[model samples]
Target: MSNEHITTGQAPKPVGLYPHARRVGNLLFLSGVGPRVAGSGPNDSAVPGLVLDHNGNFKEFDFEAQVHSVFQNVKAILEASGSKWENLVDVTVFLVNMKRDFHTFNRIYAAYFKDNQPCRTTVEVNALPTPIAIELKCIAVIE
Candidate 1:
């Protein structure tokens, strides 16, 4: 089956050289999304923001805020591919400090994925971009 790349205006632009999402057959693969804003438009500024704080290094990062931002980013990609969160099959959550932020992460995560909780895996890592706490990548099916 042929594959297609998906992009949307509603989410933050990819920080590096990568498509937001790609579809092959009935599966859609989404890249990890962070809290940076692509821009208001083509000529606007790209704003890079924080998502967590470790000691004084990751200061200004907000757990809930970044989680919501990641969801919005995923939503934009999914919608572009004629899918939604309900179509998600698996999700991988990466955290800088799982012990410190697991509870807060679950509380905020529940809001976005209320009913059909997809298969998920959460892992603690040593660090993230600019010391951010969390980053999420997912896979979903197109109807």
Candidate 2:
């Protein structure tokens, strides 16, 4: 089978020059999906996951809310590819502050992946392209 590039309006339009996800054979690879809201157009500013300061550090960050938005965006991309959360096989998460936020993120992650939990690796990064504290890049398989 040939590769299929996927895009969806339900999630925020990608800021970079890439599709939301791509399929090669039965496996699908997703781009790093952030916690931005789907803006009206490509150039419109996506609503950030939570409040932030000039330095892009959290002033009053809501980890749960940010996690929820990121997961929702991931869900949208999966649905667009004829898959769902259950089909997710792996995920790589980026967190701006692992020491401060990992526990909350892990709790929320547990709620989302109550079963069929995919293998995950979370890392602390200096920053994300957006002001959010979390992002997810995932992989799934479609029948």
Candidate 3:
């Protein structure tokens, strides 16, 4: 099977030397995707409903917005990879603070995945490489 690296202008540009996703055969594996808007840099304050100071301190933060934005990003990548939201087979979520965000994330997640319930795992971490609060690593099958 041939492997392919995928990039899309519809989703946030990757922070480093990595494509948004990789496709092997019929499987599409997405890199960790965050909530920063498309065409925004890693350190920019373009994250949906998030703001930071010059010292990178949080000036404003909205977990709900981040959650929605991340999902949008994941969807964009999936479509760009010849797949769709319903094609997702598995998803792993990363949150900066599980206690503070899990409830909200779960609420929003349920709405998005109501019809296409893919296997999902969520975990807390100290931080992500960007200012966003959530990220998603997804796997989908392209039929």
The whole-model lDDT of each prediction reads 0.74, 0.84, 0.91
TM-score of each: 0.81, 0.89, 0.96
Top lDDT hit: 3
- Put down candidate 2 lDDT per residue, 1-143, tens digits, no spaces: 86999999989888789999999999999999887886434444354546667775656767777788888889999998998889999999999999999999988889889988899999999987766678898999998
Show the lowest summed lDDT stretch of 10 residues, model 1: 38-47
lDDT (Cα, 0-100) at 16 in candidate 3 = 95
lDDT of 1: 0.74
Residue pairs of candidate 3 with colliding backbone atoms: none
lDDT tens per residue, model 3, 37-66: 976766567899888888889999999999
- Higher-ranked by lDDT: 2 or 3: 3
Of the pair 2 and 3, which is ahead by TM-score?
3
- Runs of candidate 3 with Cα error greater than 4 angstroms are none
Provide the global lDDT of candidate 2 against the true structure: 0.84
lDDT (Cα, tens digit) per residue for candidate 1, span 40-138: 332223324552334445445567766776677777788988888899989999988888888988988887789868999999988765335677889
Instruction: List the lowest-lDDT window of 10 residues for candidate 2.
Output: 39-48
* Candidate 2 deviant stretches above 4 angstroms: 40-45, 52-59
